[model samples]
Target chain A: MFWNKEIETLSRKKLEELQIDRLKKTVKKVYDKVPFYKNKFMETGIKPQDIQSLKDVTKLPFTTNDDLRANFPDGLVAVPKGQIIRLHTSSGTTGKPKALFFSKKDVDVAADQMARCLIMSGMTSEDILQNMMTYGLFTGALVMHYGAEKVGCLVIPAGPGNSERQISLMQDFGTTTLHITPSYALYLADIMESMGIDPIKDLKLKRAFVGSEPYTEETRKKIEALYDIDVYNSYGLSEMNGPGVGFECGEKHGMHLWEDNYLVEIIDPQTLLPVKEEGQVGELVLTSLNREAMPLLRYRTRDITSIIPGKCPCGRTHRRINRITGRSDDMFIIRGVNVFPQQIERILMSTQRVGKNYQIVLDALDDITVRVEISKDMFDGNMEHLVDLQKEITGKLKAEILVTPKVELLEPGSLPSFEGKAKRVIDKRKL
Target chain B: MDAIKQISIFARNNPGQIERITHILAEQKINILAITIASSGEFGVIKFLVDQCEKAYECLKSEGMTVSLNDVLAIKLTDKPGGLYKVAKILRERKVNIDNAYMFVQESRKQGYLMIEVKDINKSMELLKGEKLQYLKKKDCYPRTKKPVKSSQSGK
Candidate 1:
């Protein structure tokens, strides 16, 4: 029943051996082709020969987002420019976004891993998959789209939003699986509730793969309760060739990060040293073992999570990583869009008629409500003027953040003034 | 033929919201002459015709509520059967559509008032003017109270 039973259930010894072999090849390839990794290797005085077993991987330098930023466009690409088939950029708060390149082989391997993940989650070729993720420069959608297609599923590339149409498609096509963000899944549930469409009785939804944002188990349960389906937690980033990297099996314990493709290490953020003990929370560091386009060496994810201690009952030797707890940075995600508080501040400060104080409040439904105080002179005691001002602010914020947020105008000095650090965000989400 | 000014507030559709609005008005000693709520899924619009409309609007605004003011036709009814039917017949004959309508009846005075929110308040007003309809001004929305007679009190 497994997509690749031999690789999935390989013994620990054989898996480690495969990992070491792939690691040595990846280190040599990067050192030979990409000057960024080669220079780092030279600076550390560690050659490709320095890496022997999996434990010696620490000698190589760790790659951070800053390093990616320094080498902006294609400095880290390991293959020739003609070999790159796809490119995805990870958003940053300032400066140019970090670009990731993938070759045809890399794409195929990603889809293969995705197929393994889906098969582990009990998906079969007979299933109908309705992918709800946005398909664009973002890698989340296209990768899963390829994976489900590889499984011979009747794939409906129904992109995100438009709840009524989504429901009709589900009703007409009998969609069996979904790939959606947790927030959008909850939002669709609300829409279904208002339209009197019961999930269990009306739709044929069996399960979902929720990712692209860090969510708590409580939020997962709420989604499961609302949709009457199991939601598997997925972990991936653009540097790792998008989401087929790690996924929860049918056991629903933890996400089994595909160790065959990725060498994962948990390190303390302060010490920058690997956490020796399992089940201890730390920042996730991943190295691409099989990627050809742009293989990153010990790439720091900035995501905080831990490796599960015990063996999974699924008979797979790949270790599982716990659900992501928090981020090492202050950036927050809403509606699957990465947003920074500084970005909001930049918009509010530049916009005319905006007061000195503004607050970004995230509600339980994963909706963002930006509470902005109107300047003293701007509040002219006219409802039309106030409404127009609110609309203008919303348009500006949406243009910057790529997601429309509900804007609320308040009286001057309505928001509390902070002494030192102004807490710009008030997250009321139960998650 | 003055149209009544109504205050409308945009709020999340949840319990205790109407209570919150009414409590604010009650604390300000502003009486609600007429009220109606229209919900479109998660959020709804709460409309109100208050005794002191400007004061209530300003108060709600100061409380950081998303409130707006609009004009609604306040047609005086016949205070009996076929009262609304008469208006409806005239509206239908003239092709004047009502987006929303609610009634407020003062039993003591045998006076009935019908509030109709139309697409174009002035156009509807002009169309209904020649239909022998009397419109209630803003001040006329309040119920009239009679002074107690001294002779009746002494006899009692």
Candidate 2:
């Protein structure tokens, strides 16, 4: 019953063969068309023909986020401007956002992988799927929308937010499946209970695909119990053509990453060397084999996760990836918006009243709160003025991160200071 | 006009903050004639009308406490319940804004004294003079007997 039974259940040897073939073509194309990659390869004394087998991939240099940022608008483009059809970006960065371009075929191939993942998440052509992922420059909504259409399901591109209207649409359309983030699922469940309508009774939702942010097992259990349905974790980044990169099947173990289209490697961030052993946490470095417009090689993901050792019960030959524990860097996502504590520090440091020490507390995915200490001299016993300062910091933080955070002003020495690594972010959401 | 010196100290409403300030003043042998506390949330203002206003202001300021002194109107009234009501009604009638004020029981016991900080002290003083109300000077507020405590104050 798999969407693409042959490819989904391909043998490991066959999958590796397919990956190597595509990887060679992608390398040749990038070296010829993109000077950024060409210079990197020339400096490293390697040619496209040097990568004869999958094992030789270790010789290639890694593509880090800094390289992407340095090559701003179209510096990393492999394909001509005439063929590029779409562009998507990550939420927020200090400078320009992470950009990914897709050609016509790249778009179809991404949707095709998404269709396979949809089938794995228990969606059939008979199912009426309601997608609640956000749309626009963030690729979550549009990718899933195209995939659901490709699966021949009755699709409602609901986008995100407006929980009340989402409930109504689910009832009106007899929706059987959903594509939403795990945090939003919890929010919707609470809304359904408040409306006095049981999700299992009033809505026809049988299963859900949750991703775009990391969530805990306890949250997964709560979502499954609240909706009386299966909750599958999906994983992808905009650099990899969004949500189609990997998915959880009926087995509900680690997500089965599709290796036929891309090359995936786990490397120790400090050493930058491959961790071949399974079940060891490391940063995910990926190379796009099938992407035409922007064929990224050894693109460092900065996501810390392990590769599950054994083969899955589901026939997919692709290796499984454990749920992301944290980022290799300080970047964390709140309600789908990527945030860095450095960005917060920069904003607070620029403001006059804010002190040197600040802490970010993410209690839940949606409950993002920042506690900052104000300078003692600024607290001149004026209540109205203090409230004004609080409001000012709140507005500035919201504008910087695109998500409004509850800002609190503490006294001179309330927040803790660390001598070592500075544990400024306390993320209780990932527990 | 001899200005009625009022010292304002800004502090957190923590447990030992006000106690510490008052203890320092007590050790300094400074007479605290009138005091008022207005606080909202974690922080507030502590106003004081003491015998040595400049000394107390410099003392707290040197100790890194946020403190400031403002010249205010010190009105002398009869020691009765209606004394404050008469002063408030007069200021209200004359369109003089009283920012804040506090009254103290004078040593004579027959009369009451109030230190009021208003928007314009000159205008309020003119209005008080027209109403035949007596405004005390700096010398009348603090006594000559209190001048000998500074040597011991600075000795510690």
Candidate 3:
């Protein structure tokens, strides 16, 4: 079940040795080529030669999102323009989009790592993968497509949406796997139900790689039951070469983050220091050890998760990290209480009589309103039943988030359907 | 045949929502024989007694509206003051709680139908049978007047 058995199961001592070597090279290259890293190193008074051990990576200046934005286009590129083979940008819904460049070798290495992830997830050459992620400037679709092709699977480049065609392609080609966002997977299940196509009986899908949005384990279980397939949680961002960074093996416990390619760290957001103990909630910080075109050192990912403190039964020496709980930036305050959308998602998905889609609205008066769709089967044509369901959702949310949010029960398709990532929060409160 | 199939739609309690639902039914050529809307907070349930219940359900569902169909007793209401009270008393005497009810008059036939939603349809039907109340069949729920009663006259 391993794409590269030797590298995937590399011993901890050897993995660290390989990591230190790659880290040293990446630091030297970034300092020599990219002025941002050179200026950062000069200001910190840390030389590339100073990074002699893996622990020395802590001395490197952290790369924040603002730093990437301030640098803008090509300021972070380490290699020559001719050597760059591809480029991808972040989904910058707020301001300027951060860009990442890839050289020819960088593309190969990303594909290799993704292949390892897919193989570890039990995909083989015989499987047909229908990649439902958008194949554009975003790195999610293309990188996964390359990885699935590397695994020798017949990849159907079926980009997002056009649900009928996606299902027809699955039926015609006998696709056994899918690379989709968790929200889109749920949305697809809705589409299939309408089309009267039962995924368990009609299609040949055995597993799905769901990522690009922070979702709860409850949502994963819901998708799993809907399709009767194993949903492997994928963890990656465009800055870290899309979705090959971390992947769950067949064990389905936690994602086995590849240590040889990237060094992972968990640090408290407020203190900006490494957490005292493993499994404590902290912001994830990653450094690209093997990337050549854009070697990010101590890049603050701003994703909130913890490094699980045990060995996975999958036997990959590389440690696993829990699913990304929520982005540090996605957390919002209501009535002096911090709430992540995933917390609300967990409550809504686990509770009965609640549907798959929900929206959290923060109005001008600082009141929180949670809009949820009623489960199709739960409606018994009684108005009191709908009222009771709304109150139940409100009670459950209040018990979890400690805010008595006004729950609005909407019809199934009243909320906007997401073709890409589902935008669950709307903060209209005047600051 | 004892119970009439009623389609209920969950919609936002806003202006034009009924217009939208009626438009969708009109587009599908489905006739709304009798209709009632009950609002609860921000949303309301629009229940309909349509000429083609299954077609209406499929069309509304395909239009991506949250809709459901259930069996409810449809009894002919006598055109008198005690007509509603008579059925209410029967239900109260039988201890069958009425969840929802609506009445509409048939302009063409001078007949009226009272739709009643109770917990148990069969039990309520049995209770009304001893009272000699006439239950409307699914076919009887349709509007007797076709072509708006003006278009055909204009053609003549």
Candidate 4:
């Protein structure tokens, strides 16, 4: 089967033309087979023929997380259960997990997209890729495994945790590429340093593909410095067919969306209209170009990002997207003020003598007050300096987030440490 | 001094919640003499030293709060800045990790009593005893005075 090669490398005008054609076809397909889409179309009184181009995409109703949750298990699946070969799901922290189905053809297309991601990150068939993501219900490990195999690379299905074994495999098997979250990689680097094993010198690792959670630039630098490995950020969701939907090339400018397999749009989050300006951040809305069992149309990702046009240094025709800054859901309002945990993290990391170990505590004291507990580094002497550090952090926080956060410098190693995503924000104001 | 139980209650950090807890104890006539709130964000564990430890635990538990009866070393140290550091250094040398801790000072004695909850209770007690740290039982320091006898005797 041939992919949309022209659309992948097409000019903006021609790419839009191709997208309009595919979107029309996708809408028609969903209208014919998928009851959910057909009903939505009928209710909106918009015919599939009317959606002849990308501009007319807004004519169709927007798909949401609630829609997926409402449909539940097989309610949203376009193909029959017998036709579906694989299933993936979100964590379902909010409620019941949103399940997605994939036909054999759909799985192949996803694998191809993943292969493209690996290639973008400079992976070769000669390279042995060590997948350190969580397996089973989580799609990171398995999808990367399939995609690496598709790229003709030697795949080692080493799921997350078990750092000793991961290091051993890296040393013994001569693993050259690593697929894991950025935080876990840092944890591995910390362990390697404590063991006096220089990951840069001891292991033959060259490229590190990091994702599964949003990361900061400082954290990225720390990881790169620890292993001396070139880090490329990968972006995808279980809803969008796992960690191969888009990836960063060698230029490291932005993640190149596999436009052939997905049509992407950046829309004003509040207005739900197309963002007209360049460099303006908006919500990412994706339409699956070649999904079979469950193709999504205008599905709001809720991830804030900007689109970058022009040719990439890697010569791939696919469009690039700026790194996702933060999630719309992660933004919490306190005292009629908006706050993102990432902004607090950024401020804390920028401060002197403060490690990345910090947590935001929102307490209800008549009005909401934000308390930030920062883990102190033992090496940074002068306890009095911490008072000044706290002042500086409070000042910066008040300036950036527009609130004077109560900053507490805890004793070294006093705060809880996590092997997984660090719990940075604790909202106690709800009580 | 009899061996008195100390209970740690984890509650969401909020205003008036602590007052509600104190009110429950007051209603049950369980006099809480010493308490320290070590809070981070909206949640923190409130460590209490009450006259009737069992009654206090029952009161808090009946209120549907997750309360744990823990063995903590209530040691009296000189009310100075380095007093905490000395205790921390001793624990470090003994290889005992302090999971959580809190402190309160008696105005009359001019000394700070720290309630340290360590991972290894036996090791911590042994170390404190071996080092001759002035450790006191919870009831020995309950109420800081013997004024609650009339209420206990009246049984009202």
Q: Which candidate leads in TM-score?
A: 3
Q: Please give, for residues A1-431, the per-residue lDDT of candidate 4 as tens digits.
A: 11234445567677666677778888888899888989999898989999766778888888899999998888778877899998888876699998988899987878888887777677788999999888888778888888889989988889889899999999999999998888799888889988889988899998888888788777777888888888888789888888878888788899888886788888766667887776555689998877888888899998877788678866677888988877767666666666666567667767766666777777775233334443322222222344566678878888877777777655334468776667766777676
- B11-85: candidate 1 lDDT, tens digit per residue: 656898899999998997778877888765444568898877767777777776767777888888988789889
- Return the TM-score for candidate 2, rounded to 2 decimals: 0.58
- What's the best-to-worst order under DockQ? 3, 2, 1, 4
Ten-residue stretch with the least lDDT total in model 4 chain A: A375-384
- Cα-based lDDT at residue B136, candidate 1: 82
Chain B TM-score in candidate 3, rounded to 2 decimals? 0.83
The TM-score obtained by model 4 is 0.60
Which pairs of residues have clashing backbones in candidate 1?
none
DockQ each candidate and list the results: 0.04, 0.10, 0.44, 0.02
The CAPRI category of model 2 is incorrect
Per residue, candidate 2 scores C-alpha lDDT tens digits across A1-431 of: 58899998888888888999998998899899999989999999999999999988888878877788888778998888999999998855577788889999999999999999998887888999898987799999999999999999999989899888899999999999988887789888889889999999888889988887777677898989999999888889988999879889889898888898889898867667887577766788899999989989998988877799987877778899977766778667788766667667767888887788899999854778888877755655444566688789989999878899988777656678865457889999878
Quick one: best lDDT, which candidate?
Answer: 3
Select the stronger candidate by lDDT from 2 and 4: 2
lDDT of 4 by residue, B1-156 (tens): 123357666555678768978998899878775787766554555778777766677666666555556566776778877998887787788777766666777767688877766666776666655774676654466654344333322222
Which residue pairs clash within candidate 3? none
Q: Across residues A8-88, which tens digit of lDDT does each residue of candidate 1 receive?
A: 989989999999999999999999999988888889799999889999988889999999999888889988899999998
**The 10-residue segment with the lowest total lDDT in model 2 chain A:** A376-385
What local lDDT score does residue B82 receive in model 2, on the 0 to 100 scale?
90
Runs in model 3 deviating more than 4 A are: A330-431, B1-156
lDDT of 3 by residue, A25-111 (tens): 999999999999899889989999999998787899999988889988889999888999998999676789999889988899889
User: For candidate 1 chain A, which ten residues in a row score worst on lDDT?
Assistant: A377-386
CAPRI class of candidate 3: acceptable
lDDT for each of the candidates? 0.83, 0.82, 0.86, 0.75
